[model samples]
Target: MYLNSIQLQDPNHYMQIAQSSLLPMLKGALYYTLPLTLITFSIGLILALLTALAKISSIKPLQWIARFYVSIIRGTPLLVQLYIIFYGLPSIHITINPFPAAVIGFSLNVGAYASEIIRAAILSIPKGQWEAGYSINMNYSQILRRIILPQAVRVSIPPLSNTFISLVKDTSLASLILVTEMFRKAQEIAATTYEFLLLYSEAALIYWIICFILSIIQQKLEGRFDKYVSH
Candidate 1:
């Protein structure tokens, strides 16, 4: 039954089946793909900012803790991390629903990676800027908020945007955790129709198109930022 008699008789029928299946898969992307990316990226950005600040803090304990956190997250495979959160957490009487578990796992992973990008951006600023703030009798917090971070954000935009583009792809991993994302829908369809390659390739194509559009937006943002910096 894997080979439909009709499709076998006329191979062009395979194209028809592929086209028919594509719309539903696209709808799956609209419902789950964008929402997952937006929520995960939003929460992840906050965590990344806090973690980056802790990494750069003068307090030794904070620096050590942040380093430990980033190392643990970055060293492990993301799938293993998802399993630890979703499947392992129940052992400790910490039970969370699957959606939240996926979000938490993805956010933590993104935080670790994005924190490094932000920290590097912060470091790239001239040391003289910090000294000037101190010379003006401004505190570290004031200098960071008013002087350092503002400039660093402009520099961070390109890398941070790339991180987000990557996050959009990573959300497919959520399907393994039972989040019903686009890839999950494709798997379900493939199981029923026994057309794994076609459905999976369609899913990949959709992901590619989504990322391509995001890359365009990223270029526009970079152009505007470049103009602003040049001014």
Candidate 2:
């Protein structure tokens, strides 16, 4: 197979092999990449919100826990984190499958980074806003729900969108843990046919296309959020 593929390594034939590989690679994205990103981001955002709030809370223990979590996650490499979850945990008999492990690892990684973004956005609000809400008889929860979160969301949009875009790209790392995402599919095809360059380039192109579409959506969302501020 290697010799056969090498014999056809001319431009036209190379492209044909890559083109044939495209559909499977793309299907991997649809099934694994997109779903992993969406699920991980959704969970991560929730974790971020909680961690951000805990960091800002007056309670000392919550603050410490939040800080520690952010510190550990941010200080480590994501690949190592994934390894701990997928490979290292079984030392204590806590084992997880690859997809779940990837989800958990990516969520923690995104959560830690996103928490700082959210915390900064929340802190950027003036003290006067809290006072104003209090003057109107609003409790902290009510004010946070009605006033603070809405405004903070606008401020958080750009960075949070950026984190999400990064997450989309980072999902490729899931393939390392045995999740059959697009990059993994490319690797499999390349291994069998010994067409590493073409297959890898094709995979990169697909990732670029996905990220490009995400950037466009980010801009539109930012514009829409801006309208709310304008009024």
Candidate 3:
């Protein structure tokens, strides 16, 4: 009725762990992962739209800035980038906590990549569309806000949703900086109880469930949006 390494009078230590550690760990994941993915991805999408516009702008400086940002983020590993922001920033006067720093780094990285997706979508919109928007007395911003961006978003939805799903899983990496997400909590429980297999497996189960729910939402959104595609 006890683990060899400890003095606990519980016959169902393993089963108890499945209920105790897993249920809350899943909630912790939802707490961090859902907000991080949704907030960061939404902000990133806005930044991406601006960056994409800058990339194609007639102004050379804006174009250069967009290209450089995309190059640096895309060329480097996200973990290293995160370490620099989370750990390296404190070397100077700029000190941020692990969670905020992770969010910033993730949003920036998503922005860089998503900018390209946005740019490609915008570029794919026909010249006639642009001309038509102008003929309708739409200014540049108005045309983009109304005519262009709507189509671009529709075209980019599938890839952008995939990026969001990946971001949900990637949020686990924030645990390395001591964010105490689901996986980190799982590790803590495993270390405390020596129930490594049980706790870790439960953590994996939680991740799968979270991702599955996101997948269902993504599918429903896709179906709803696809109705507009051919019409």
Candidate 4:
């Protein structure tokens, strides 16, 4: 009888509920998720470019270190990576809040993956371009900066943007460490209202909307870059 006895006393309380917490939760989610995606992606991009250069360098130590970093980061799951940042840090007495931990972890993981993409793009450049740079008496760094990297960046943009888009969705994993992003907000709302379906569905809808906008941005960026590549 208790199960059947459950009912909305006001019958329209959810309309009231929507006004009170739901709107704020959506706003909180956006504030965290967008910044998380942008900051992590920017950090990861700079790191990837540097690491990819090291990977291709003739310097043995740099090549080895680059290989090692990529192997270790790629071998682990990002969830475990986050746990190491949030939980493992305290064992050595180093501590950070959930947001910074998530940023560091996500950026490092994305950096490792993006390094491979960058390395591949750079390598795809024709050998003749480097030869032409050498013929012009250009040093390795000059050749890379002037002739190779710009083309590689154009090739890399599509994949890098896609990686960042994936990172946006991944930010929800921050909830495990108590970062109050979208999924965490949904869980909180569900707990308070016992309307798990409605609350979570609304949260999912918000995420989809954000991702849809990012998709539009991605399409425009790809189109812009594609114009240069088209024969």
Candidate 5:
């Protein structure tokens, strides 16, 4: 009878914790996690485009600089990058808030990785496309802006979308730096309730649901883009 009673109470306890924690966790995701991903991805995409252009440029110095940047970022673990920005920087008397530090870390990491994707997309455009643009008396800038980028954007969409989804998951790392994202909220609740498994599971479910919705949106966007390209 005692064992059965304990078993009966366990479900109720977990349910109560879930009911109480869900709203605060959702608010954390909405207010912090989503915004962090969106802002960092936007900044990262711009940096990636510029870095890709630099890498492909004829100027040796520009290519060297871009290559060095990409190499360093790709070589290091992202958690170390976050730690250096948030914690190590204080040793040099440079202190950044948790949110900005997260933004900077994520943006730089994304830029290095995404630059390669963007570069590859640009290169995938046939040499004939450039020639055709030239045949029409289009200058290099005009050709790139009007002809090359449009096709590159199309080719790059799928990879970039995947990167965006990954970033959404990666924002959980921000919690370590004291950013009160969903996972952080989960940690807080778990710490108090001693329901680590339940709260963390709840957080994971929320993340999965968010990612699932994003995946659906990604598929729709891909289909729309494919139709446009086909037409």
Candidate 6:
């Protein structure tokens, strides 16, 4: 009976801790995690589009440069990339703040992986479509902008959405560089409270909730795009 009462009290204590920490952690997520994901993914998507175009372009140098960039980014672990930007660059007297460093690392990583998806989507468009565009006296740019990219975007949606979701989780890595994101908030709270399991679980729940919401949004977007494509 005494042990049971102690267990009940412990839960109440943890509950209070959760209630207290939830707001600050949520603030961290809102202020840092979401912003990092949006900024990096937006920048990365542009880089990916350019890289994809370069990969398919006739210019040998452009293809080579794009391939090299993709190889370097894909070959290295993202954590190492973050370390290089945040830690190693200081050795060369080039320093970036924690947020910018995370942005560069995550953007480069996303660009490499997403470029492949974009390139494949672009390539998957039937050659006949391009021929039709040319038959209509459309220039290469017109063909791509009007015929190719629209189709490619439809095909790329799922994979790119997955990448965006992954980026949200990856933003937790920013904590290692002292970026004070959601997971960092949990860590700080845990350190003070010495409640590692409870705090970390709460943080994990928050991340899962964010990802779950994103997954639903992805499904909705995919359905909307599919409907558009079918028409």
How far is each candidate from the true structure, as Cα RMSD in Å? 2.8, 3.0, 3.5, 2.3, 1.9, 2.2
- Per-model TM-score versus the true fold: 0.92, 0.95, 0.91, 0.90, 0.96, 0.95
lDDT of 5 at 86: 100
Best by lDDT: 5
After best superposition, candidate 3 residue 17: deviation in angstroms? Answer: 1.2
Over 4 Å off, model 4? 1-19
lDDT order, best first, reads 5, 6, 2, 1, 4, 3
Model 4 reaches what TM-score against the true structure? Answer: 0.90
* Shift of residue 52 alpha carbon in model 5, Å: 0.7
- Sequence-dependent TM-score of model 3: 0.91
| Higher-lDDT candidate of 2 and 5 | 5
lDDT minimum window of 10 residues, candidate 1? 1-10
The runs of at least 3 residues in candidate 2 whose Cα sits more than 4 Å from the true structure, single-residue gaps closed, are 1-8
How displaced is residue 200 in candidate 1, in Å?
Answer: 0.5
Candidate 2 lowest-lDDT run of ten: 1-10
Q: Write the per-residue lDDT of candidate 6 for residues 42-106, one digit (tens) a residue.
A: 99999999999999999999999999999999999899999999999999999999999999999
Candidate 5 local distance difference test against the native: 0.97
Tens digits of per-residue lDDT for model 5, 61-157: 9999999999999999999999999999999999999999999999999999999999999999999999999999999999999999999999999
Question: Clashes in model 5: which pairs?
Answer: none
Q: Backbone clash tally for model 3?
A: 0
Instruction: Identify the superior model by TM-score, candidate 4 or candidate 6.
Output: 6
> For residue 11, what is the lDDT in candidate 5?
75
- Candidate 4 structure lDDT: 0.87
